[model samples]
Target: MINFYSFRDLTRHTLLLSFIFLLFLGEANAGVVVGSLTENFTCDGQIYQTFPTNGDTKLFEAKLDESGLVFTPRLSPNNESIEVQIKALLPGANSVSLTNSLAFNPIDNFLYTVVRANLNDGKGKRLIIFRIDRNNVVELAGIPENNGTIIDEAGANVSSSGLVAGAFSPINNLYYLTGVRKPVYVVDITDMSFKKFSAHNFNIADIAIDPVSLSLYASNKRNSSNQLVQIEFDDINNPTTIVRKGNAAPISSQVNDAVGASYFTPAGTYIGYQNKPGKIFSINLTTGRTTVLANGPNLVFNDGASCPFDFEVDLDNSTLTIVADDAIADGVDINTIQATLLDVNGNGSERKEVSFSATNGAIIGSCTTNFFGKCLVNVTNVKAGISVIGATVSDGTLTDTVSVTFIPGAGDPLKSLITANPTTLVADGSSTSTITVQVKDSNGNNVNNGGDTVNLTASSGTIAAVTDNNDGTYTAIYTSATTVGTATITGTLNSIVITDDASIILKNGAPDAGQSVISANPTTLVADGTSISTITVQVKDVNGK
Candidate 1:
């Protein structure tokens, strides 16, 4: 069935279908949809072709009698492969050549292309930039047209060549262009002005950026083979210089000649396209390792761009893990704690900040994770007790906790004893005696755990105050009362649950004979010896008791 539809309808239909497919494919299966310029109108002498077997499930295609632009979607190379090509069209245009550069502006939802155009006055060809919308609509892009003053490149002159590569950086909303061994030309889309800066050192072929980190990646043959390098800007907003960061390992030979590169943000994957064999591969941002995914139409003037896929944090599926020793010795022990964060797929998320806390010790409050999604902090000045260490993300979305027990170097409090220096006190109510309590461990050695709570109590006398000697002993003043009795002094070690007691005697003071008074029951005793009357007498001391 052949149903002819307008280019707009076809574009909308294709976009809807692709969106639906992507919805079904979760983050793990998500891929980068790329549109680049092919070397020739016809790829490898085939007008239309498809890879049924040993092909990436995501399609790659080229067309005949059309512009050099071709669209390819790179899928999980290790899992599935497919290749296909279909007819392409443009409004009121049949054939065109995009030999210079292609970039997609995510903010404006327009594809920008720099192409050579000729004037009707026979003034030689001049480079003109054009923008295309999703509905296959194209228009001259650079606004407030410059009279060759803003753009000073030799190629800007209608007589010479111009840009060899281009990339659109969403970080600063600027378009970048460069030529062979030439300084980069910064194009401000807002003002349509070009500023030149010699920041890049390599002969850049194509550049891609990670919007999250603003890391600019370039594919260049600076060291004899095409390799991936990261370009760091002094300031993305107002950049004056740039430095190149090389990969830790060499790029695979399979992607040695890769000319086009793009980053798939959903999976944190970098993709590269090679024209020599029309193959696609993935590049490791740190190691520069490449894994070929599929083969398709050969493209020479190739460059790709895809929307930075936003990955939602799975709060329920993501996990936070903490690692530390369960038990720490009393002395000379390392107290380092570590935390790791992983997404739903169990892959580490880099550059995340996490906070740490402890219950009974001092610890580093926060730490930022590295490339491995891991961070470390130290716990110091811990006490002799169990402490819980907790780690949580900045947003408090994920959390993990662990417990550690610190052994006391001095020893644990076991038993307690109470004693009085002067075990006896006068009953005058003004006499006081010294009371002391000592604590010992299981080995009968005086020990201070720095957290011992010793309480003192007296059955008769009053304890004026108690003082912790800070060693293993405590002291208190026992005030005596007028009544003669024995004060049972009790000492309790609250932390270790041990108790002991000692007795203090309150004895009567010396009787004063001068103050003593005597009384007789019968004042007048019968004087007669024969009348022996009963006589009774009472005596009083100084206290009148």
Candidate 2:
């Protein structure tokens, strides 16, 4: 016999189903979790994307979450059969903004191209520019494939100004555009005009401008070795490499097919780089020393095909997100890894080494081994500006150098002007005074016996005695005659005019008794004493005159 379900029971079941549906909707609408994917590549015609099924099919997605806020990575299409690599995620307008390259333009919608993927700028369109629409979509704006000339027929990478360091100069309100080959051009975006000066043949990789010093720093990668050459430019148009051979450390290994990326720390004290094996290293710009702070696990799968292509530092979070690729035959093989937070003790030394797995995107292993022990050399009691800080890590099997720059304090050295105790006194009347002065350096340290001198001169008064305490202090005594008048005194140092115009007052002589003086023909009674006499003398200031 068949039985029918009760109406109440059916109603209860329906309510339960509705409640479950609402719960699922809430979860879907909820913001991204800590490790949840916020963005991913779907199906874009980019060579940099991996196919998972075929090594040649560059078609993968870039996955991101809210945790990866500052970084915006993208995949570009390449005509070559080989797999393409995404090197960096530069600043963009919004989430959908993707470009072949990244550069800062003075104008709102300037263009740029991604040159060597993870290597150096190779050839045609090695330097390209793009424009972003209001919708945040990137389009090819300028693609100057020409190897020479500042402006081509197509108005590609041509700039109003001549050759410069990078495509952008935020400090000087300028922008540069180059043709990958020769002649770098610079333009003054403030005035919307091109500069007459142009930089000659020079391989510029990354550039940084010092706003305070008005100096430009250009990183040049050598054609033969992975070494980086540093060039300083007074103006972006005319570049000069301060070190011909470049800094002491090499940016990358000598192995073939290796690439590196570098950036200056926000503080500008250190420059950091990311290489294969998902490692991060920094060079002290002042000392020219390099130190490896974090080294991720070596890519052993896919015959070392698993490598880190590009990386960016989120100084706010103190975390580094590396775009890693496990170049297996399928698109699903492409992935990214968040490097373990390095425990640096301000000394540029690591407290421990931690490695995470890119496959699971989790912490895999860690060790307390000090890799820099052999490479670090101790440099003690060194002065600022190119002082070598050496460290020996791993028992000195390898060596490394660190450059340290020390900045001096600001303000004048002397705190107060020299002052005298009794600035005004009677001359030749036996008056004692103290001339005191305080000498110090910018650091507030007393500059004892720094060859300081003080000369006392009398404009009207006489100096009976003068003595130097030798501790930035002095004393002087004066004697005045019985003449009723005022005297002026002054002080000097090495003709620098330390102090001037001090005054002293002189009074009349004392009275005596039983003394008589003869006067002129009228026989006037002139007495030195006996007759009570009261005198009122007005004090006069000599220097006031």
**All models: lDDT?**
0.52, 0.33
What would you estimate as the lDDT of candidate 2?
Answer: 0.33
Writing each residue's lDDT as its tens digit, candidate 2 over 1-545 gives 11122223333234324322322343322211001111222111111211212423222222212222122222333333112221112111122111212333323433222222111222222222333222223332322222112354445443222222344554343555432233444544332233433333445433444322334444354554444444344554343332132343455452112222233332232332232344444455555555555543222111100011112221222332333422221122222323222112211122223332212121123233222211111111111122322222222211222233322222122332445556544433455455444443344433344245555665444564546566544456655543557655565544345433456656543332323232344344459665443443333333211
Most accurate candidate by TM-score: 1
lDDT of 2 at 91: 16
Worst 10 residues of 2 by lDDT: 301-310
lDDT of 1 by residue, 167-262 (tens): 667655577666445566666565455567653556556666666556566666655476666666666556566754544235677665646534
The lDDT, on a scale of 0 to 1, for candidate 1 is: 0.52
TM-scores for the candidates: 0.40, 0.30
Position 282, candidate 2: lDDT: 48
